[model samples]
Target: GYSYSNTVPGPIGSILGPAKDPKANATLPFACSLCGSCTDVCPVKIDLHHQLLTWRKEIRVKGFLPVSKRISMKMMSWLMQAPRMYRFVGKMARSIVPYLPRFMLYNRMNDWGKQRELPIIPKQSFREWMKQNHDDK
Candidate 1:
């Protein structure tokens, strides 16, 4: 039997309900892909993705995110604010990631890459490409 209430939005919405303790359900929102599929199919025209995003913000604000994730986000924030460092890191990743062993890249520490093959790293970033192709003009 098909169960409509078992979808991503149902459980997340239930856990995020006003009477429920959102702090206890901090990890629920991150489970969504934010693809808006649930929003599209909703007969009531509920903005499910927006609700998920709001829950994510609430989780972050309440400091419920894991330490490792918080540290990584901080590091990424720092890296993005430094233009030179960002470019350097991008260059290094493009040059190095392809040659890294599969075991190293797809290990448990890399949850995003564990289940799927990573896309081929491009030789240059979009900024580099734009500079090369259009800067002369």
Candidate 2:
């Protein structure tokens, strides 16, 4: 759980490089949310919740994910942040809602799925919601 980075340089401090080891990263194991979305979204239908927990143990617990995968995740975060591009994708998502599978579209595997309904995407956006509900008065 402790980060020791004397081998390479990272942002903030270098745990794997030259800075003193951080007391630790999170020590807790990934607990199962048992959300079925993983299963539903899985192209191969693997029980991803189980797989996720397993990977968490192997990776977070054992330092197992490939470096490429870690880099790709960082890349994905960057790609997701462009407002115009993200909005284009959001529009596509809304357009595709009618065709999205129950598992992926509905968040069915999520623990809260049992009690929660897939919220209707409103015709009006959140800004509209705020405008209707929030008055200077």
Candidate 3:
């Protein structure tokens, strides 16, 4: 998985460069399960899993990550941190995703729906169910 790139240059060099070795790029770390075996086995006790996470951030900063992935992460971060927004977006997505045309949901833009059938949104959220059934009387 490692290679010396003195042979590669220019646009080719960018792909094979020391910093951007395509073989050693983001996908390896993304595939990792973070089992921490690397961290445990290192004689110097390096935080290997943490280092892998740091590498993901570096890859993201270097604009190696996909635009859609970056946007989705940002959207998730914003939505998850705000309770009302989370509830609203969750409800909205549940309502809209099912009704969306197959072309809209299964396009290249939606990587998730491209490979798999979209999830069926439930009729009621947990909060809504609990409100009706578990309300203080």
Best by lDDT: 1
**Of candidates 2 and 1, the better by lDDT:** 1
Best by TM-score: 1
Expressed as tens digits, the lDDT of each residue in 1-137 for candidate 2 is 23222233222122121113222321122323556664677677665565444444555434544455457656667768886776666666666765777787556335345566667765555644788899565
Off by over 4 Å in 2: 1-76, 103-115, 127-137
Q: Which should have the higher TM-score, number 1 or number 2?
A: 1
Cα error of candidate 3 at position 102, Å? 0.6
Please give each candidate's TM-score: 0.69, 0.33, 0.60
lDDT, candidate 3, equals 0.66
User: How many times do residue backbones clash in model 2?
Assistant: 14
Per-residue lDDT, model 3, residue 32, is 51
| RMSD to truth, every model | 4.4, 15.7, 8.0
**Model 2, 83: alpha-carbon shift in Å?**
1.0
Winner by TM-score between candidate 3 and candidate 2 = 3
Candidate numbers, best lDDT first, in rank order: 1, 3, 2
